[model samples]
Target: MSNLTTLLALADSRLPTGGHVHSGGIEEAVTSGLVVDLASLRAFLVRRIRTTGLVCASLAVAVHRGALSASAGESGDLETDARTPSPAARQASRAQGRGLVRLGRRIWSDEDWDALGPTPHLAVAAGVVGRAGRLADQHTALSVVYTTMTGSATAAQRLLALDPGDVAALTFDLSALCEQTAAEAAKDVTDLSDPLLDVLAQRHVERDRPLFAS
Candidate 1:
């Protein structure tokens, strides 16, 4: 809430970091004709947010609460199980995690750097730090969700000729979806569980390099 600068820096696409590189399988989807237009792109992003992003946000809360300890073995195993449906998406999630953690140590680490590692998944790692920053769970969830959408959209714009205004409005409109997804993810049950995303992620890994790392 108070440290908007920190949040923005973490979420910004222009941070010299490589957030713009990976498309979370959007590139592959687009290349494979799974996503072709503004409407399709918007729908893809929403569904991704609701499924993958939702699970990530939920994992963040779970990690923050100590309800789900993210030791390398535990986190990896959990992510693996969650990712059995889509290995590529899972790889993308971890790629973002590595990128975010590397950035986190540079920007956020001080005395609390100890809690920075361990998490192999980006969302859980981000939640740990966000919670440490005293950020609300919902706010933390939104930050992660928006960051992901921004990254994917940035990737899309670079690869296509869509209207920037349309993308901007889409991002704004999708914020509502982020809220709903985050809210659902915060629930006590399997708030983050999504079948379609899991499958897509696994399928993403099966394909060779077309576009998008994840």
Candidate 2:
């Protein structure tokens, strides 16, 4: 398959990465009334892309570029752990990372996979997968940024029973921002934090019967 095809496959929500069960903190946002309608959802997505999205994309790019390696003990996983303040968010990320690593191992035969340890962070796993797949740094960054928005948007749509057409349009409208953020991320790793997101993630874990993991 072509690189584009592989990238698309990796970005697919149906990739069996256990991604469907997590709402990227949107569940808590909705429960807290921080995001109710299309307008608020858009704002939430925008903020997410600027904060966690950028950090994730940059980490992926850095890993893809060989600037950080799990084997060399310069793992981006540590950085990811430090940047992610919420234990819930960290657990969610590692769960997804394990899924990605499982799929990646089945597809590629590389020793680098062992370097990732048992549970790499999602961004670190993404970078390793991108490198193993021979995808461009920009492509890896774009994938990270794109998923950062789409995953939460999808959860919001289901939770709110939102019009799919409206949600699709919203994602389409944010494509430019995704591209710009990816481009910036490909240039360098970034450190950004969102305290509200952290709080929501923590709160989500405490919910009696949460719809999503985080």
Question: Which model scores highest in lDDT?
Answer: 2
Write down the lDDT of every candidate, Cα atoms only.
0.67, 0.90
The TM-score values for the models, in the order shown, are 0.82, 0.97
Worst 10 residues of 2 by lDDT: 68-77
Misplaced by over 4 Å in model 1 are 75-84, 111-119, 189-211
lDDT of 1 by residue, 81-106 (tens): 46435555555666666676676677
CA deviation > 4 Å runs, candidate 2: none
Backbone-clash count (model 2): 1
| Model 1 poorest 10 in a row by lDDT | 111-120
